[model samples]
Target: MTNALTFFEPTRTAGLERLRNFAPDAGRHYGERRNYLGTAKNPGAVSALSPYLRTGLVSQSEVLRTVLDQHSAKDADRYIAEVLWRSYWQGWLALRPSVWDAYQADLKRLHNAVQTQSGLRQRWENACLGQTGIAPFDAWANELAHSGYLHNHARMWFASIWVHTLELPWQLGADFFLRHLLDGCPASNTLGWKWVAGIQTIGKPYLATQENIEKFTEGRFAKVPGLATQAAPIPAPPHPDRMPLWNTGQPDPALHSGLILHEDNLNPTHVLDAAGPIAGHVTVMATADQTPWQMAPHVQAFRGQAAQNMQNLLADRIGPAGPAVTSALALKQWAQDHGFAQLVTADAPVGPTKALFDAYDRLPDAPPLVRMRAPLDADAWPLATAGFFKFRKHIPALLARLS
Candidate 1:
């Protein structure tokens, strides 16, 4: 059978249309059925717009606007909160960038352990290969690898099993998802796994019971055995105090500029609208920088193709666009070769793309890198200084600001 992931087209037009089609259901219908874990052939109630949203093919504001046009905030509150959760995670990590650094360090150590330790390697390999022997867990593993997506409920259950039942390292589990999930975002994926492991919220690990799985899957995974009963929180250091969000300076019209597009923010129309005309454009593929290990072939292909789709979408605005380039040296050379006085692009949140940009900024004699953050992020991220509950309290005001 063809891979179920092919159903998701990686383009702005496809993303926008998906959002439009899902908007009418964004309210009560979504609230009622969002948790059902239907198969890839039938994804039940939830909107599978995450890949688009994660890669910036479509902006959260645009999604919120579309949904709200069809339903009131009260009517669509659940869906709206779900969308804002992404921003909250991004902002939360942006403030405590050390969390991301720590995750990377931990991933490297664990990756090395998997290579050097035979028993551990066997267990990790079994889990990744979907030979775990637990039916639901094994099915989810295969589903994620085969489809590049999973239901939200399934994700929580899968993470719980990985950390508690399978007795595997949570970082390894998170890495496994990042390698496969089409919408695998740095902040959401890492922090989400951390949350399930009880590290993000501290002492509130998500426990998946057999009965809960049966309920959500509508008896499909009933009577599942070998699930852990207790979910004690993983030990972790106290969260660092929130740092100020980065101040992305306004783009200067007078300077000769080039637009740099990347996987994090594929669509640059808003950037172009704000920054005015540019001298040239360049596409940067930083998906390889997501991990030290080789990313899944599908993940790489999807991002590369999505970037190309963006280039096609913005063909009119992009002058003398160059081929897709990777690495800081290549980006610097491209900027200099095009005679660009400065480089402006969409603000990349805390992830591989941001790391790539940070490296480029530090390079000696590199042109100025001006990041243009979306107005939605500029307003929403600062409110994420606390938990989702507190951050969510401001959703109404944030939505108002978008109007």
Candidate 2:
């Protein structure tokens, strides 16, 4: 959309009012025009709910349930299918954890290689700065840098340019997006770049053609030079020797509990059962400092919002909000000081957060750590053992259950 404001902003009531109000109509309307990009002055077509969904501001099931409550299963089928897309991606990545490892390796290799190649580095710089001669692609590059959001369709085209035209490593492209996009995700972002590189899908990679970009962008941008005339199949990297599966040991509900909020998954209300009294709440954010901290402004703002929400929610159960801290040591100290016997957090899918927590040697003698996987993901992971098509087959049944 011309206007970059998302449904996740405070001016939009941060999606609570909009979600509650538009859910009934969301099924039919969203299914029909959800892909349309509109300006900031008016963003009526799409739900504008990705940021909230990215975070746990609204639960995935709650959105599905609300849509089902309004529209019939038959009527809401398309909208319901869209909701499951995220679940499918997450499940697919979980099964193929090697994807995450290979991405990190490729990122490091490309970052180092590009530093030595002046020509390649210049092209990468131009693409990132939106100075590339490709009009539509350049516009999208600038949009992502400035807005931290892009329509899904635009994302595909932009990725195609970075990989094919600029000839940069796909992992670098994915890293650039993660460092920028507000809804920047480990699974979706990495997996998406792989798909465009012809690794996620067997042999078919998305190539950005001038005609397609012109048609989809509503004639906004037409001239994209040096476009890849044909697609090249990039063989998928061999899966890692073994994937690290999360240990699912439920902790006692009665322990003096504290919640640790990370970017892994934002919604805790669903996973963190209020079965017993919750003692205190502590919110934590790990800065994605893997690349240059270009998105520091947005990151700082999001951290503040996350801590504020956690503080507000815990005010009734606990007294005042605990301090929002950045360091793991500081967070652990807070947990220890508060006398928490158990720490609750969402399952880290795969990325820096997962890597950080995986390093047990660097951690303190913390409380019992509990990671909760969403019920949606719990159901979808089994289907994800194979391929996206097999995963796609479950979409109907998945929607039926959610409905």
Candidate 3:
């Protein structure tokens, strides 16, 4: 039931086909009613594309391109904006890496503090186990545990409840979500948790209430008692000076290409297409300091499958990297042994994979790293330098550029 296995079901194929079929309708409908959680009896009108997109079965560009082809710019604008939100979060976190560091530091501090406070630990454990004694919150908690899915609104309210009402550390709550949610993303998860705690927006923490929950849930959840209102105020981490984009160097058709698969870029077949003639391809997934807790068995199995799929795809071109290696020292050793002077991969933005590449990128004699930026991100990230409004203004031009 992990996110990985949840996809690849017949349901996922149907879901992708649904996106292709009703995209126009979905886009237009989502434009107007994206925020409305229809009823407990019916899920919201949102296209549940995250699981597929997360696994690289469908690219974001493909999804957006398909929608735009079916609907007018005027009608599909809101849906497009929603898609760009992922880009905004990624770019925002990338430019301000300190926010991530601060989150890690605060999470460590809070985790230690929670160990000393039995009352807080018990509440947190209860929250994790969906035993918080609050009907709506408990329901969502169980939903996440059982189904690995939560409606967008439910996630916000759940996060708000954990941070404000329960008086728990926001990072712990965010980590809990990241570990459980099928679409648990680094940028979205980190920024989202910060947003709930008032750190991302500066003094504007989200607060959940029985009234709002009932309103959104269409009265599916009505009675809940004993929720706190105050969220711990976390200061916005100071923005880091924008680092100039490192020259990935020119793509050399003559050089052999090696591959590194990170969570950010789960699929490499697309890059292999662009890599021209390759002497060899080595698929590597280094989960070395990836502490997302015990990953579900399905997740582990899916990674194995993905690696096999990648290897099968590249069988004619080259060989796959053997076993999962979790050390920088070993990575360098492998790179040297393979005689690959250039490593081409799908770009990993602002995540552990990116961090690993950053370390490798700095190595004096390391191979040339050519990370292919997805068309969607390459177009959207520059717009993200400012606010969403400014970024929204570029949509027409952006889509036009794509065409």
Best by lDDT: 1
Ranking by lDDT: 1, 3, 2
lDDT of each: 0.87, 0.68, 0.68
Question: Which ranges of candidate 2 are over 4 A from the true structure?
Answer: 1-7, 10-13, 20-25, 28-44, 223-225, 240-244, 287-296, 318-320, 325-328, 360-364, 400-403
Model 2 agreement with the true structure over 254-347: per-residue lDDT tens digits: 7778776666555566446642466766665664544533543564465457556655654675433467655667767887899888777676
Structure candidate 3, residue pairs in collision: none
Q: Which stretches of candidate 3 lie over 4 Å from their true place?
A: 1-4, 7-15, 21-24, 38-43, 228-232, 235-241, 268-270, 286-292, 302-304, 310-321, 362-365
User: In model 1, how many backbone clashes occur?
Assistant: 0
On the 0 to 100 scale, the lDDT of residue 204 in model 2 is 76
Which of candidates 1 and 2 reaches a greater lDDT?
1
Model 3, 154-221: lDDT tens digits are 88888988888877778888877766655667788888887888877778899887788777677777
lDDT of 3 at 17: 83
Looking at model 2, the pairs that clash are: 3-40, 56-267
Compute the lDDT of residue 138 as modeled in candidate 3: 82
Candidate 1 lDDT score relative to the true structure: 0.87
